[model samples]
Target chain A: MSELTDFLNSSGLANLDWRAAVMVAVGLLFIFLAISRDMEPYELLPIGLGVIIANLPLTGMTIFSDNLSGHQESGIFGIVFHYGLSFWNLLPPIIFLGIGAMTDFSPVIANPRTLLLGGAAQLGIFVAFWGALATGLFDIEEAATIGIIGGADGPTTIFLSARLAPEMLGITAVIAYSYMASVAFIQPPLMKLLTTENERRIVMTPPREVSRLEKLLLPPMAMILIILVVPRSAPLISMLMIGNLFRESGVVPRLANAASNELVNIATIFLMITVGTQLSADRVFDTDTIVILGLGLVAFACGTVGGLVLAKLMNLVLKEKMNPLIGSAGVSAVPMAARISHHVGQQANPRTFLLGHAMGPNVAGVIGSAVVAGVFISLLPGG
Target chain B: MTFDQDLVNQGLTLTAIGIGTAFGILIVMMLLIQLMGWLVRIPARRAARARMAADAAAAESRDKALAAVAAVSALMKSAGPLESDAAVPAKAGTRKGAEG
Candidate 1:
């Protein structure tokens, strides 16, 4: 019994930090947000649980090796951190692949102008870039990576952050995905603030039905454009388009099903654990992290407004009226942003149908945000 | 610091800044492409609408032509030199009956 007590005393539990305790509370909050608020429950729940478990005070489980001189080589969580999460930055790309497989490009094909709103919405990316640089919160690469959180694209943010600012990858990704999940709540108020009721209620004529040929052509054309314009975005964009191509090719039913299902699940598990490991108490609860979260919210708000206002301007110049509410769909939160636009539009006009049209900007937002990330990464001095 | 250390530090800083500028340019280009996409669609949408209207008109014309052809066939049948069965087949039928 005395020998066992001595062994326990020699362990690192005596050095357990207070930050670990606080992180547990934060992790629980994420769980509440996921379960109670239904905010990205699929991702946030697992990530939240992983964070809580990873941050627990030393239980000798995290320690991997011990020396006669009392030196330890690794912790249980450390093993998960190094091998499971750090090396496998594969989640973002796979998630994007799933998104691509699920997306229908028909609306964008019908009204290509929505692509412009998608691009314009990325204004926040640059805005946040300057914001990060001017504030001196982080260096150029890290700042650019963090600023991509404004694009509301988790995969792009993760890809860029992993490449440019690997250390900041964890928080940046979390902030990006969290804001995207909650963007529904954040965007509606901003949309209401910018446009009048008339603009919101304006019912535009329905877009023409898109053809199968156009549907097949769109993802490839979009991929080609990305390859020519910004090679850096090709990884995420190409994979996305390929996933979509698999779905549209009609001959590859098995590949499409796999890309959208098992492949996504496997990638997500790795990604969530890796991301959760980054929330190591010491790193995430710091002053810089706090600033990153606040700035992320600002960037998201700006992107939302930028897209809507540009759309409203287009409405002014064009003969056919475009509903300004569709602009809020520019944040690239996918079905969520489109759904919010539809809901808000319906509130203004009972008969207004904006779901299909809103989808154009919604999908555009994804591509636009990625392009934005690429530009910022390319232009920044250290990036 | 040593020369090597100084070089490493400078390289790291430059890499960070390079990433930022690259990302900035990417976003700007996207905006430009978006603008061009919007402008290009105006003419295309108008042309598509025009084409649709023309197709509808063509479909209506084809229906009228088919109707005229059907009417002509019906009139020709009714206005034939031997319009009724009685006119052409009655003599044949009477001869057969007498023979039997």
Candidate 2:
């Protein structure tokens, strides 16, 4: 009878706390959203599973060490969090490399003017940084981490949050990704509200056909220029450009394929899951989290507005007028943000093809945000 | 104060620096792209010029060969008509002799 009672008490059911119950429900919501809605399924599914595993009471799976009691066990997720994120910060660079290998720089090269629009889009990062600081709930370091969510690039948000505020890494990264997915919904209203019917109807001329030699030279040139300016950004940008070089060289399909496919897949799985496991109930259920969410949205909206404003401004001076809708793609949600620009553009002018035009700023946004992130790293004392 | 004046000041400063640096680098990258375009054009332009020269040389030889063939055909055409005329006269002379 005593043995049976002991076994019942020792089970996960009896040991579960109210906070753990709440976190599990949160995890289930993410899982449900992923499976049914098909929203970032690859990222959310693993993260949701990790969240459930971490929150469960009396599980040694996520515990690393308790100095007070001298308890030590390296869980699989814990080890990944320590080595992959905390110590070395290797995951984001690998993801960047994969992004580089798969990316096409022709649109960007054909229209270097779009690079400024990409730079303009990063205004939201500082906007949110200001907002976070104004709230006084977070210091500059934490505020900077929150500010980066405005960039809308998952790997960059993850990299910055992991570097500066390891504690906020989980929630900040999740928020950044969620907002990136929601950009399709969030950007259209802003794009329409900001632009007139005439502006939306603007059709851009097709970009020039780029040469093979030009494509091959871009990676190394960009790598040198960017890294020379911001050495702290070397790891991310170098990997990104090298991956691009492999693709353009026409001599290394196998390397490019592995970087874009196998290497990236493994890193994303480990990185996303590790980030999810760090989000405890204590971290999730807070006034600050609510505030951060509001700031993140503001940041994204401001970023879209910033890009639109620049594009509109550019049209005033330039002879070959640009479609203002393409400016919103500078937020760097990859093709999704660019697609939003194209979609909104079609609503106004059915014949106008904006996807190629929008992609110029879209890829530029990736480099723009990384450069800003490096600035943040250089100026601030990280947590 | 609801907000820290010092933190806000720092934020303002950082915001300026961040925006300035990002734009500066992008502009530099833009100029670099233009410079690379010019540099990349040099080799391509040179190759195009070299190809044009080689084509001119080939065309020169082909035109000379065509002229030689035309001259040869013209000479053969002129000689054949004169020879046929003389042979016809000789045949007439033989006919007269036979008749006599």
Candidate 3:
């Protein structure tokens, strides 16, 4: 009888706490959303599984402890977290490489004015930065990290967080990805609210074909120029341009294919899971976490508004009218944000095809966010 | 390294610098892309036109060759004797020779 009682006490069910239970529930919810709602299944499914695995009692899947000598011993997930995320800071740049290989520069090159929309969308990052500081709840570094969630680029957010504020890494990464997945839901309403029916229905001229030489020259020129200005962004910018050069060079199909497909897939699995392990309930269930979440939502909304407003302002001055709807895609969520812009525009006018135009700002937002993050890293209290 | 002191002032400074630099860098990138596009456009158009002209010339030559082959085949078909008639005469000559 005593043996039975001891066994019962040692079981996972016996040791389960409210925090772990809640985390498990959250993980389950993410899984459900990924499977049924089809929200970032590649990212959320792994993250959800990681959450469940990390939260389970005595699993020892992810362990972090320090010895009397103050030497830290880390488990599998912790090793991934340390080496991939913090120590070498490898995963995000690799992900950027994949993104670069996959991206089509023609849309952005066809319409350079839309790049400003991408820049404008970064207004949300600053707005959130200010809001986080005003709360007096977070330090400047944490606030900057939190604010990057508005960028809607998961890799950029992780990159900035790893450099500036490693403590809030998991939550900010999760929030950035959550918002990115929910772009279909979050962007349309804000886009409609910000723009009028006529503006949403507006159709711009078709983009001219970007020359192969321009495509080949672009990655190198842009990389050299931007890095010259912000040397701190060299790591991310250089990798991104190199990957793009692989794609545009037309001589290395094998390397481009490998970077875009296998390399990205492997990195994403490790990155998402490691990020998920950071969401232990004790770390997440705090007033500061709640504040960060709220501020993140505001940041995304402000970014959407910023892009839309800037597009409207540009239309007042420019000869060729612009579709304000495409501006909302400037938040760096890739084709998803751009697709949402196209969908909203199509509803207003079946003839209006804004996908190409939206893609300009969409990709530009990636660069803009990386630049903003670089600026924060350079100018903030800590280098 | 500590961010706890004068956080708002630092935040405002960051906001100003970050926004200003982002816009400036991006605007410059935009202009560079435009300039590059313009410089490359002439050569690109020339290459495209040359390719199109070469394709058209090749297609025209191919069509002419095909037409000539068809005309020659038709002329040969019209001028040539029927195989049955020619074979009948040969067969007849063979039978006559055999009978002789």
Candidate 4:
């Protein structure tokens, strides 16, 4: 009876805390959303698995430290989290490379005006920054880290959080990715609220055919110009352009294929799992995390509003009309935000095809967010 | 820095700077893209002209080849029966000579 009691005490069920159980439930919910709703399966599924594994009472699947000897040891997930996310800062840039390889720049090249919309969308980051500062819940650095969640870019959010406020990395990354996945639900209502029905129905001319030479010139030119202007943005922008160059050069199909498919897949797994391990109950259940979540949503909404307002402002001076709906895609959630724009436009008018137009701002939003991150890093007090 | 003071001072300043820099950088990017487009078009135009010339030359050579093949066929057709008739008579004469 004594041996049995000891065994029971050592069991996971005996040691499981309420917080850990709550986190497990949250993880299961994420898994359900990934499998059933088919929303961001690659991100959420691994995160869910990581959460469950990390929370299991005595499994030692994450970080373990000995306080007396001042010795530290990390499990596999913790090592991945440290190397890929915290220490080496490798995963985000690699993810950017994959994004660049997968992207089609023609849509952006077709209409350069949409780049302004992307710039406008970054207004949310500042709004959130100020908002977070006002709350007194976060310091300036933490506020900056949280504000990037408005950019709707998981990698940029992670990069900024890891740099400016490593303490908030887990919640910020999770919130950024969650919002990205929920773009389908979040963006449409905001887009509709912001734009008039007439603006939504407005159709612009089809984009002209971009020359192959133009495509070939774009990546390198962009790389040189951006890196020259904002030196801090070099790592992310440079990797992105390199991947895009491989795709456009037409000389290296194998490399392009590997970057887009295999490399991205491997990186995503490591990134998502590592992110999940960071969501230990002690970190995630804090009042500040809740505030950050609320602030992130507000920031996302502000970005959408900013883009729409800018588009409308642009239309005031322009002869050719623009559909303001595509402006909502100016958040850097990639094709998801663009697709929402397309879907919303189609509802307004079945004939409207806003995908190509939205893609211009969508891709530009990636650049815009990276620029914002650079600005935060360069301008912050301690930075 | 304290929250209220920082929000009022540095926050506002950062806002202005951030927005200004973003718009400025993006505008510059837009101009650079335009410049690149214009620069690339010069070479593209030249390449286009060169391609057109090469295509015309190729067509001309192809037409010449076709014409030459037609002329050869015509010559072959016109000369074929006479050559065969001459050969037939020479063969008959040789056979008669051999018999005698």
Candidate 5:
């Protein structure tokens, strides 16, 4: 009888708590969604694994302690979370490096006006900022990080949260990624509500061909110009542009291929899993994280609205009419937001193609958000 | 974390600065991109125009050469019998003169 009682007390099953079980369930749900629905399988799968592993009690992996000589010691996940995330803030920027290599700037190069639409999409960030402040659950720096979820770039979300509100990194970054994956479902209704039937039917001519000179000139020019204006944006923008330059230089196919494929893949697995591990029950169950979760959808919606409104406004001023659906792509979700615009346009006119046009703003949104983040870092206290 | 009047004021102010700078940079980028496009296109446009002019001149010269060839061919066809008769008399006269 004594041996049986001792064995029961020492077992993993004995340490299970309701909160840990719930978090594990959440992680399992993420894994299921990723596998069955084919929604961001690369990201969600690893993140789910991290969440499940972190939530299990008595795993000894949660250990983060100081040794006798004042050296810090921890498990693998803890080491990564401390050094890769809060301690150094390295992973998100490395991910940005890959993003740059994968991106094509030709769309924005073809039509520079779409850059304004990308700028406009940033209004959602401001709107969400106000919403965050109004809730009385967050302070100014935390609010900035929360507002960035509207930017719809997961890496940017992680980058900003790492600086402003390190505790909220998991919630905000995960929400941002969630919004990015659901762009197809969430954006169409808002896009339709904002624009009339005529606007939806408006067909965009194919973008003009951009010169090789323009493509080559762009990364350097943009990198120099943006970094000069907002010095804080240098690290992220520089990495992004350098990667793009490698892609465009044609002399460095090996470097470009490596950055886009191997470097990005490795960084992505680490970053996503790190973010998921941050969502352990103790950190995620607080009032602030819950409030952020509720407000995440709204913030993202505001960004879409901002883009659509700006496109509509630009049409009013310019001679050529643009499909407002493309404006929603200004939320920095890259090809996802751009595809949503194209999909919605297809509904009104099956033959109308807005993908190329929307790509201009889609890419511009990435720059815009990075710029906004730089501005926030400079202005906010945390940086 | 609790919010206060100071926080609200800060939020509003940050919103203005943040949005203004983002839009400002983007708007400036848009302008600079246009400027870059215009600048790059100048040399290209000049080259295109020069090429077009060269093509036009070449086409004109070709047409003139073709027209001159056509005119000579027409003259040869229309005065063929006359030239042939004249050529025969001239050749006989040259032969007589040489004998005398």
Candidate 6:
């Protein structure tokens, strides 16, 4: 009887806060949504696990502690959290290395004008900036951190928020990646709302062939430009470009493999753990958290509209037809945004194939969002 | 480093420079992003086009083979066994022997 009582006491059912209970349900929903509905399991799995770990009571693992050595021994997450994230600014750049290795520059190379989509998608970032200001939720620095949600790049949002609004970093990252993961669902309806069926079905003429020399030249050229304009963005953009150069150069497969596999895997584990440590229900349950999450949804929606509208405007001026659905690809969710573009185009015309074409703006959005992050950090105070 | 900090501390001039520098890099990355599209898109687009062309060619060849087979089948059906049997070697030999 005592053994049975002890087992029950140790179970997850015991000593649970109602809020923690609710969060555990949310965690289960994340798992369900990921497996049953096939919604971005790569990110949601870690985030769901984070939520569960954070909600469990009396673990005493995440809290800081002192050891018998008389030197302070931090929590499981504390050592890396302080040294890796809080002080060093390490996670974001290293994560970019993996992203770079995975990205193929060929789509962007074929349609240089797609850079405009990147620029247009940034409209949401600035709008969120003003929105945060008007709401009085934060000062300019913290406002800048929250506004980066419109950037649609998760790592950059985490990096900037950690630096500028360490307190809000957990909520900001959750909102950013959640919206990014949902981009496929949210973007399609938003895309249809903004674009006519004919506009959605517009078929672009095939582009001409590109050369090996051009692919080799692109990353360095981009880096030089990024460094010259926004030095702060240089770290993230430089690492991304270097990763790209390594992939295209054909000689650096070893480096490319390492960046994409080993380095990215280790950084992701660390970043996710540190990110999980921040999800103390006390931090996430505040009014400010609600506002940030709401604003993040708004930012993502507006960015979708902003890209589509800009494409329509360009179509009016240019002789060539631009499928407004492809414009929705101008958010930095990478191939997911492109896939959504393809899916929406197919719904309009079964014969239409837009995946390859949408990729141009899809990759452009990555650069565009990064540039916006640089702009916000530079214009706003608190760095 | 302290001297640089002192210069930055001097006024808005350094700040403006910093802002300008940020914008400058943005413009360059923006350009590079476009250039990458141009570089990548052309080849990808061409490959897609070539693939479509190949598919069309294969489809046309398939149709032609089907049409040829149908034509042969139809001719055989319309002609009937009488014409076919008359053309056989035994009948042909019988006809030649009769003439001889």
Q: Candidate 2, residue B69: CA error in Å? A: 18
Cα TM-score per model: 0.77, 0.87, 0.86, 0.85, 0.92, 0.77
TM-score of every candidate's chain A:
0.91, 0.96, 0.96, 0.96, 0.96, 0.92
lDDT against the true structure, each candidate:
0.75, 0.89, 0.89, 0.86, 0.88, 0.75
Q: Cα lDDT of model 4 overall?
A: 0.86
User: What 10-residue stretch in candidate 2 chain A is worst by lDDT?
Assistant: A63-72
What is residue B74's positional error in candidate 6, in angstroms?
A: 50
Models sorted by lDDT, best on top: 3, 2, 5, 4, 1, 6
The stretch of ten residues in a row with the least summed lDDT in candidate 6 chain B is B1-10
> Could you give candidate 1's per-residue lDDT for residues A1-383 as a string of tens digits?
99998878766565557888778887899899989999988778777877776687654433444355756666554555444434544557778888888888877767767876776677677567666765766666776787788788877887778777877877988888788898768989998899899988989789776556566766777687676877767777888999999898888999999999888887777677567667778788789988888889888988888889989898888988999988888878888888998899999898789998999888888887776566655655644
Runs in model 3 deviating more than 4 A are A1-6, A65-73, B1-5, B44-100
Reproduced native contacts, each prediction? 0.02, 0.70, 0.79, 0.52, 0.77, 0.18
Give the per-residue Cα lDDT of candidate 4 at A218. Answer: 81
In candidate 4, the residue pairs with backbone N, CA or C atoms under 3 Å apart (3 or more residues apart, or in different chains) clash, namely none
DockQ of all candidate complexes:
0.08, 0.48, 0.33, 0.28, 0.45, 0.09
Query: What is the lDDT, from 0 to 100, of the residue A310 in candidate 6?
Result: 82
Is model 2 an incorrect, acceptable, medium or high docking prediction? acceptable
Q: Distance from true position, residue A248, model 5, in Å?
A: 0.6
Score candidate 3 by DockQ.
0.33
Error of 5 at A13 (Å): 1.6
Error of 4 at A342 (Å): 0.9
lDDT (10s digit) by residue, model 6, range A1-383: 99999988987678787888777777778778768877767666676777777788866556554456745445666666666666777988899988888888776676665666766676666667656766766766776777789878888888788777777777788788888889977888899888888888788776546578777888899887776766777768888999888888999899999999999989888787567657777787788888888788878887788889988998998888878788788777888888898899989987778787778777777776676566555655655
Model 2, residue A39: C-alpha shift (Å): 1.4
RMSD of 3: 8.9
The weakest ten consecutive residues by lDDT in model 4 chain A span A64-73
